[model samples]
Target: MRLSRYFLPVTKETPADAQIVSHKLMLRAGLVRQTAAGIYAWLPLGLKVLTRIEQIVREEQDRAGAIELLMPTIQSADLWRQSGRYDAYGPEMLRILDRHQREMLYGPTNEEMITLLFKDGARSYRDLPRTLYHIQWKFRDEVRPRFGVMRGREFLMKDAYSFDLDEEGLKQSYEAMFVAYLRTFARMGLQAVPVRAPTGPIGGNLSHEFHILADTGESALFYDAAIDEVTREELLSADASTITRLTDLYAMEEEEHAKVETCPVPAERLRTRRGIEVGHIFAFGTKYSASMGLSVQTKEGGQVHPHMGSYGIGVSRLMGAIIEASHDENGIIWPESVAPFQVGLINMRADDAGCAEAADRLYERLREAGIETLYDDRDERGGAKFATMDVIGLPWQLIVGPKGLEKGVVELKNRATGEREELSVESALARLVG
Candidate 1:
């Protein structure tokens, strides 16, 4: 993508309303614009990052044996009523009246709806276990929504529902998702720790919220330092017992840990940090199924409610979380795994015909080699180009200038480390693609 042709409306001044680092950076970087209170219109650059994060979540979900599907943003209130939560859900539920005077809502979550759908189709124990997921927008009427997309009223989410014949089966399915969550966050350059939490509205006996530690995070968290050592590969291939051992690491969000007067992990091994909640999972047995009459035929020819679980990842919030967890004074230092563009090409002397031509050729080569590249072809000063590229934060910066062309080379800079090296055009291209 060429900067001159792009719609990025980057600003030199930070907005006073943005309180957090992510929110401020997002605005300054031109990633999004606030359309209403707690609601945002994701600009092109922001959408690309959000899409990348969603795809990673989807890939990890698929690897864990979850099938994908789509669910509507608006749902009939009758479905929530069946599960006995229509009134209990509170004002956060965006209640509305349909054309026929029927109660409808912009769904805050889809537990009741998913239960009703599965009940109508699958009837036997043969359909013993199934995990279905969808990536869609959900609305919650937060009285005070702030912090940009981190706490937006309308946001994209990846919610998965699991069904099993018994409690034991439900646990196994839940563990699969647990492992998948670890892999998913790691792939996006985050070390999100799973912390036990109270199942507030979802109403489950067992629940965990995955949190990424950041000084500006909303949730205060306590955990064993060892939890940080677990890798994506280890979690991805772990058995149920191996995944279960994660709970033994002694981690809890503020609400859960506040109940315990004494800490379990000892002073030395214990670690405390402010964390952003990015994902959550719950295994709520028979809550919705029993209420909605979503039962399957057992082997003994009796109808029984299946044990179930729900897993959720804040797809839109992750972009903010990533920025919070991975930024410097200049701007966001995006990880290559989820960066909007892998490389940024800056025409440092765009007014110079020679520099512009060389930069254009390099951009073509990078694109032809299938590298995700952004070309800054704008006729701007070198310092302005440099600052803009730094704010957007691509993994690498390819600098083209009249001086560099005379030296028979281009300058390459690493975004994260601020390291620079000059090399031949061929060497730079190889470094970029290879």
Candidate 2:
């Protein structure tokens, strides 16, 4: 996309309200704007990154056999009442009333709604094991919403509900989601460690919170060093015995940690790091199902409540968490999978005829090759242009100036490595496209 045509309203001055680096950069880059205290309107550039992240999450969910279906942002309060959570959910639940004075609410989670839906249609045991997921906006009235999207009151989340006929079936469903979460974060260039977490309001005895370590993170986590090397494919392909072996690896949140004489790793490798909770999985057996009368007939002709599990990923919060985990002094070093654009083309002399010609040709070449290229063809000074491009931190950058154009050579720079090479336009194109 051409910079002149794009709506990226980048600014040099950082906003005083932004306390964190990700929040500050997001504002400076014109990625998002505050619509309310904790609500934001995602700008074009921000939306592009969000969409990319969502696609990766969707793909991973689909791979795990979870079907996607959207639920409503607003839900009937009667559903929560049926689940006996209307009064228990506390202030985080945004209770509301319609014009006719009927009780309503903006759903913070879909346990109650999903349970009612499952109970209504799924009567027999034929649909015993089914997983339904949705990527949608959620609202929670945070008393103090801070750190941009990291703790926003209104944000996007991908929540999935799994229904199984029995306890054993529920375990299998949980395992599938656990493996899917690992692959989803890995594909986004994040190493998320699964740690046992508090159930909180989403009451469940079995729960795991996937955390990405960052200094600015909110939660303190402890885990064995070996978890870093474990891959999703390894876990997914493992047998029941292997699954037990892998799951036995020591990992827990600070709340669950109890000092022991024997630890899994040596003292040096016993790492305790502050991390942001990116995703969470829960197995709440018969919690909502029993309360909402979500029961199915057994083969023996007895009514039984289906076991349920809910998995959630903080979709919008991940944008901030990723920036916190993967940025330098320059700006965001976006992972290629979630980058707004794959490459940034800098024409040092946008007004100059020769430089413009070379940049235009390179831009077309990259676009035709299926590369997402952002051409910085604005008439700015070379230093300013370089600084801007570096701040945005595209993986690859092509610099075409008057001198380089005259010599039929352009400079190519890899943003991550800070490596630069002078090559002919054809050579650069081949190197990038190939």
Candidate 3:
């Protein structure tokens, strides 16, 4: 993509309303714009990053044996009523009325809708074990929505529902999702720690929240130091035992940690840090199935309520979480897997025909090599181009200037490490492409 043709509206001044690092950086980087309080219109760059994160979540869900299907943003309030949660779910749910005076709502979560859908379709024990997922927008009426997308009222989410015939089957499905969540966050260059959490309104005896470590995170975490030893490589291939090993170690949120009279972990081994919640998993068993009259005939000719579990990953909030965990003083340091573009091709001397020509040819070569590159061919000063590239935080910046071209080399700068190396045009292409 060419910067001159792009719609990035970057600004040097930070928005006074943005209190958090992610929110401030997001605005300065031109990733999103606030249309209303807590509601944002994702600009092109923000959409690209969001799409990349969504795809990663989708792939990991698929690998865990979950099937994908999209659900609507608006749902009949009758569904929530059937599940006995209409009155229980508070003001967060945006209840509405249609022209016909029928009750409806913008769904905050899909437990009720998914339960009704599954109830209508599955009739026999043979359909007992199924995991269905969808990536869609969800709305919640937050009283004080702030911190950009981190606590946005409208956001994208990946929610999956799992139905099983028995408690044992439900456990298997829950564990599968738990491992998949670990792999998903790791792929995006995050180390997510799973800690036991209250079921809250979702209503489940078993629940876990996945949080990424960050200094500016909202949740304070107390965990064993060993949890940090689990590497990304191990998480990508982690299994059920991985859950056993990690959960066995002590970990808790600030509220939960305060309840304990005596700490189990050694003082030296206990680590305290802040974390941002990105995903949550719950095994609610018959909570919805029993309340909603969802049942299937057993092979032995008996009626039984299917056990259910819901898994959620905040698809949009992850952008803010990633930025909170990864950014530096300059701007966001995007992980390669979720970066909008892998490389920023800067024409340091756009007025120079040689520099522009070199940048254009290199951009074409990058595209041909399947490397996502953003070429800055705008008629701007070298310093401005460099600043723009740094603010957007592409993983790499390829500097094409007349002096470097004359030297038969282009400068390649690593965004994360701030390391720059001069390489021949061929060498730079090989390095980036590889």
**Clashes per candidate, residues 3 or more apart or on different chains:** 0, 0, 0
Quote each prediction's TM-score. 0.98, 0.95, 0.99
lDDT by residue for model 1 over 1-434, one digit each (tens)?
A: 99999999988898999999999999999999999999999999988999999999999999999999998999998888888899999999999998899999999999998998899889999997999999999999999999999999999999999999999999989999998898888888888888888898898799989999899999988899888778766765656665667888899877778789888888999888999999999999889999999999999999999999999999999999999999999999999989999999999887889988999999999989999888999988888988999998899999999988998999999999999999998998888877
Q: Model 3, range 358-410, lDDT digits (tens) per residue? A: 88999999999999999999999988888888888899999999999999999
Give the TM-score comparing model 1 with the true structure, all chains together: 0.98
Q: What would you estimate as the lDDT of candidate 3?
A: 0.95
What is the per-residue lDDT of model 2 for residues 181-299, given as tens digits with 9 covering 90 to 100? 87788787787877777788888799988898898888877777777667656644544554465467777777667655566667666778889999999999999999888899888
Candidate achieving higher lDDT, 1 or 3:
3
Shift of residue 266 alpha carbon in model 3, Å: 0.8
Ranking by TM-score: 3, 1, 2
C-alpha RMSD values across all candidates = 1.3, 2.0, 0.7
| Model 2: per-residue Cα lDDT at residue 363 | 92
